[model samples]
Target: MAVQPVWHFNRSALAAIALSTLQSGLAQAITLMAPRQMGKSEFLQYDLLPHAEEHGWRVRYFGCATVSPRALTRRLQEALSDFAAGEKWLMRQFARLAGQHAATARAAFPERLVQELAQLRNEKKPSLLVIDDVDRVLQLAGGDTLLREILRAFAGTNGQARLVLSSTLTGHHQGLPALLQQQTTVLTLPDIGDAFVHHLVGQYHQLTRTKREDDNPFGKLSPYQGITWGQVDEGIMQDAFNRLQRIPYYFRALVEDLVLNPERAPAEALQVQLARLQRHRVAVLSWEEMSRLDRLLLTEVAKGTRQFYGDTLRQYLAAQTGAARVSTSQVQSSLKKLMRNRVLGQEADGRYLIIDPHLAAALSVTDKA
Candidate 1:
């Protein structure tokens, strides 16, 4: 089957809102919070970056979740050099018009690379930095110190530069919100909406369209052969989107399956995707990392345990771990680990919720067993 082009749902308005919030001086940095595979990365690259540039702001993007401190620092320095060199033309014009000499211009630059990069922006042109998976970076050894340095760099008086950080629930569990409450604005990326579903339906229909002379009326027969693509429309697409929990990645996967295998119903494709997700490498690795107590906590959270440190849960943990006793601190520590790993999130009501849908589905199977 031929590969279909990527379908993008325009989110310029959301990008505008975020940029406006930054321009209004409400916050120096904005952290967009969402679950994994919900299209945060795509939005940053396709939507936010372009909008910032169109508005005359220089934009730099970095995904530093898995990199070492030295590597991350190197990448940032490279970005700084590239952007600074690109803007040197403008700086030169300013120097000529102001009649400033080379020595004074060089001396005016900030000591740090990041701060120097920020100095490139002025009232007419600002800079925006989009950093993804900031939660993981903050959890790295000495990560907190590095992050504080970056924050301080942006805080300088040199022309304004805005920071946009992205994180999952793990960041919240690790106290990201409270830690940066005074300086950061938190935004939730909304789910894929009706427009996206509508687009998928249209694309599927276009792909499945058959020629009149074809022996097979639908041009090709799908393996499942239970439903024809003719039956798919916006309503069916909306149903599939909801069933997939409005996760863009899974929904797109289901549509791709239908495009490749036209006989499969949307419902069947959804089931296939969910099954595949249950065995996903990340999910499997996370499950392996859990201790016995951590596994119990996961199942208990799936069962809606609000009082994780209570006597009943402590007794259960003690019995399960075969220990003489389980202290409240011990249970608390386990829960914190789960949160840090992005397995669970706590609500304002003190209820624990599974942050990963794949893990939650796996837990549901365990519940039935």
Candidate 2:
């Protein structure tokens, strides 16, 4: 969000919606889902953290991005040392990190881990495990098992521990929403401060010396064909916000296309930029409607550049189709389809690409459930 004079919106309201959703006990965890950069972290750091602190919840904040199953275990071990009582399961984690040769450290630690975690209950303080980008790392480890581990490990009314996992997967990540819906309470981030858009417009215009009222520069370019958005109209603005509000990364990407790249301003280039956004919205919306197997294939391909095959796809998907065996021919067709839709793309190297950062994030959830 850009800084502006004369406040017009209270962005904190978005955070309030998330804060109120927190619950104690074996009660379902609260999953903060929204678009990237919409302040998912801000909601955690500023709103939830403060309340958790007031409630005396010890926070072991972990960012799931770039974390794998192995990496995740390490981070959890470290976090245990940070917030849990003395003599935690951490030494065992350290030995695990040291490798299997360290036999003593190989001792079962879950019992000790549970004991130390239970200790948080007696502290005159409430402790909450705050994990950010919960979705991103989950995809890396490849499933919702991490979610089950976290909940099983820490979620309970013992008031000793609570889980608050947040990510920008609400409008995207078709897989996570349903997965989370099981033991996780769902709450659409309520409409933000009404002034958010107006304030943003004012700030942008003031900074750039442009305004919707004073001038509609794109109005000149509106004559072009295939432009999904044009003219800075209320409808256009709302659409941008719809994408931006659900996923903050879209906004950043939008600003880059609209304001940052003035060198290629207007006409074909401009249309292409907006077309980029529209494609992502389509993929996200469409992916949300896909079956679990189909969605998981997307999740796998999205991990990085790699050719997916029948065995690989089957390993991830519950059912297999004659045409979708994921062999060379099948992957080629799937890649072609994902690319045609503009969600999965390809590079000069011939590997499929994911042009949208938001989609990548969706593919990467650790499991808000």
Tens digit of lDDT per residue, candidate 1, span 1-369? 112236766688888998888878877888887777888877887888888888888787787765676576545444544454445747655764677765654453335445565555644678788888787666667666656766767777353778898887442343345645555778888876778898877777666664222526565753434555466778777887876667788888888887777667677888998766655514323666679988888888777667777788789889999999999888888888877765676767677777775467557668879
Task: Report the poorest 10 consecutive residues by lDDT, candidate 2.
Answer: 1-10
Predicted structure 2: lDDT:
0.53
The TM-score, computed over Cα atoms with residue i paired to residue i, of candidate 1 is 0.71
- What are the root-mean-square deviations of the candidates from the true structure over C-alphas? 7.1, 12.0
Report RMSD for candidate 1: 7.1
Candidate 2 per-residue lDDT over residues 304-327, each given as its tens digit: 637566565554443444333344
TM-score of 2: 0.53
Instruction: Give the count of colliding residue pairs in each prediction.
Output: 0, 21
Per-candidate Cα lDDT values, in order, are 0.70, 0.53
The CA lDDT at 258 in model 2 is 50
* TM-scores of the candidates in the order shown: 0.71, 0.53
Which candidate tops lDDT? 1
